[model samples]
Target: MSTWLFDLGNTRLKCAPLRDDGSIGEVVAIAHDDAGAWLDALPTGEVACIASVASDARRVELLDALCARFARLHRVRTEAALGPLRIAYAESAHLGVDRFLAMLGLCGAHAALVVGVGTALTVDLLDAAGRHRGGRIAPSPQLMREVLHARAAQLPAAGGEYAEFADDTDHALASGCEGAALALVERSLCAAHDLLGETPSLHLHGGGAETLRARLPAHAWTPEAVLLGLARWHVLRIA
Candidate 1:
């Protein structure tokens, strides 16, 4: 039977099955809080192996509620023996496990600038040689927009979705959202590129990927990189 894999991310929980090869199949996305509903609706597969950046207590809260149905369940953590990628961060423990697994999935034969733009924006770089250099995180686009809106009553709500502007307010809203998101992405990618010094495969993932994808240069790649990477990580772990 195929392996049942789950990547519990900031805003969405991705589920899929992995073939014997490194490739993934049939990806499913669910809101993080609605994971239980998915559990009740999942096919008759084996237990789940979860990779979560969220806290252990939350995982326990979820698992305790789900353990009855999902068997052989495992949660991926920094503590999990990760033999695939070369973890190069000085504070690897502080780094999100989802980001780490993503680094693995998208690494392939080329260097990757892995960006996870969701509840929080993260850009973790792996050198062409598969060396895990390091990455950074910042408030997500939504968070940034909310912050300004909360402080200044004039700024309207906006997201990473690109749109034409009609007035200063609209322009500010559109640009503020898009600009803040792309700024973090560009900053991280530029920092990584300066060190890697090569045309890396710029891969984007997470709940915010769709909105942020458009703002990215056409040269960048964002093909469910994190999900694929998480799938790849599961294969190496159990195979």
Candidate 2:
């Protein structure tokens, strides 16, 4: 039977099929600005699994559409503990399911520092034993630029390149915003090393991940972490 997984974020919706080997097949991404018009083009499947962090109204619209197409729908939620991973959040529900699921996608015996650069930059540290050690969230590079332009008026909200020494305003804005994100990742890596007594494996994902990848040479990039996690959850829940 064909199964589909959808990961809805603040800016994008990524959907894919789950293969027999437990891997995500060709992903299709739809921009939130398009208002899910592309959802109508998706093929109906036997099962649909979703992890959403979009606004309630948007979620309603997406859910309504999916309900019409799929026979079974499973919405993944954040939990205090899953398998060997134990969330440190006092109220586990407060943690975003995307982050929790991403951690689950990378779960293992080794310590890990998972960084997601999407509409927001989110960092979560999972120890060698799969214990959540807390995390941090901050404005993403695109968000920083947007906020600055929203306030300053003159600054452009997009189009710029990152550079060590920018000679123009556009490049300066890009460099500054991207630099801020890079700095946070570096700091988190240092802190994770200190707390874990060794350097943890670094994992990066999301739309902004490519922008930060070159700066983070040692990090592993897993763009489909959330979808993979949802697929895992589907298998476990059904079994």
What is the lDDT of every predicted structure here? Answer: 0.68, 0.89
- Which candidate tops TM-score? 2
RMSD of each: 3.1, 1.4
Candidate 2 lDDT over residue span 73-189, tens digit each: 888899888777799999988999999999988989899999998889999999988899999999999999999999999999998899998999999999999999999999999
**For all candidates, what are the clash counts?**
2, 0
Q: Against the true structure, what is each candidate's TM-score?
A: 0.83, 0.95
Candidate 1 off by > 4 Å: 32-39, 55-58, 79-84, 159-166
Best by lDDT: 2
